[model samples]
Target: MKQKIVIKVNIHCQKCRSKAMEIAAVADGVISVAIEGKEQDQVVVIGDGVDSACLVKRLRKKVGYAYLVTVEEVKPKEEKKEEKKEEKKGEKPTCQPQCHGYPYFVHYETVDEPNPSICSIM
Candidate 1:
C-alpha cells in the first residue's frame, strides 16, 4: 500500500469534474477523488502507489488546463488557476507548426512554402 497524496488540479464544471474522476479512477491504484472549491477544479485523490507526475499530466491534458500542481505546494486552487490564466493572456503559442498538420516537415519553412525551382520538376 502507498500513501495517499493530495493533488490540486484545475477542472471546469460538474461534467469536467466527473470526467476527471473517471479518468483518475482508471489509473493503476487510485482509491477515490474529492474535489474542493467552487470552480470544480480543486481535487484530492486518495490512492496507493500512484504516480503524482503522471496523474497531474493526464488531468491537465484531459481537463484542458495549463497548470497542475500539488495541493500542498500551492494552497487555494482559485489563486493558482487565476495566476495561470493571467499568465496565459500574454504568452501566445510559438510560430512553429505541429506534426499533426503536416507529416512531411516539422516546421513551416519546409512545409508551408513550395520551392520555386522544384515547381518546374513537378
Candidate 2:
C-alpha cells in the first residue's frame, strides 16, 4: 500500500538536515524524501510498502534521535468525469424525431388554396 510517512528528527545544522534527508531517501521502498515543517526537522517520505518503524530506527542510528510523527495511507485523487456533448457536422440528422408515427403527421405545404375542396377526414 502507498503511504506518506512523516518523521521528526532533532536537526541542528544544514549538514544534519542533509544527512537526515539522505538517510531517509536511501530507505527501501521510499519514493521521495523531503524536509518539511517550520523548523525543517520533519522528513516526509512518500512511497509504497515503506516500513515506518524501520525508517525511524535507521534515522535514529545515522542522523541521531528520530521519531515517527505520522504514518497515513495515501489515497489517490478522484478523477472528474469529462462528458463531451459534441455534435457531428458532416453526419447531421435529416429529420427530427416525431412524437407519433405518420398517422398523426400533417404537412403544411399540401395546402394549395385558402378554400379547398378536400375533406378534413381525409
- TM-score, each model? 0.49, 0.62
How well does candidate 1 match the true structure, expressed as C-alpha RMSD? 16.0
Clashes (N, CA, C under 3 Å) per candidate: 1, 0
Residue 110's lDDT in candidate 1? 47
Task: Give one digit per residue, the lDDT tens place, for model 2 in 77-108.
Answer: 77356643357689534433222235656657
Give the clashing pairs for model 1: 11-41
Error of 1 at 68 (Å): 4.8
Q: How many clashes (backbone atoms < 3 Å, residues ≥3 apart in a chain or on different chains) does model 1 have?
A: 1
Task: For candidate 1, give the lDDT.
Answer: 0.61
Worst lDDT run of 10 residues, candidate 1, spans: 93-102
Candidate 2 global CA lDDT score: 0.82
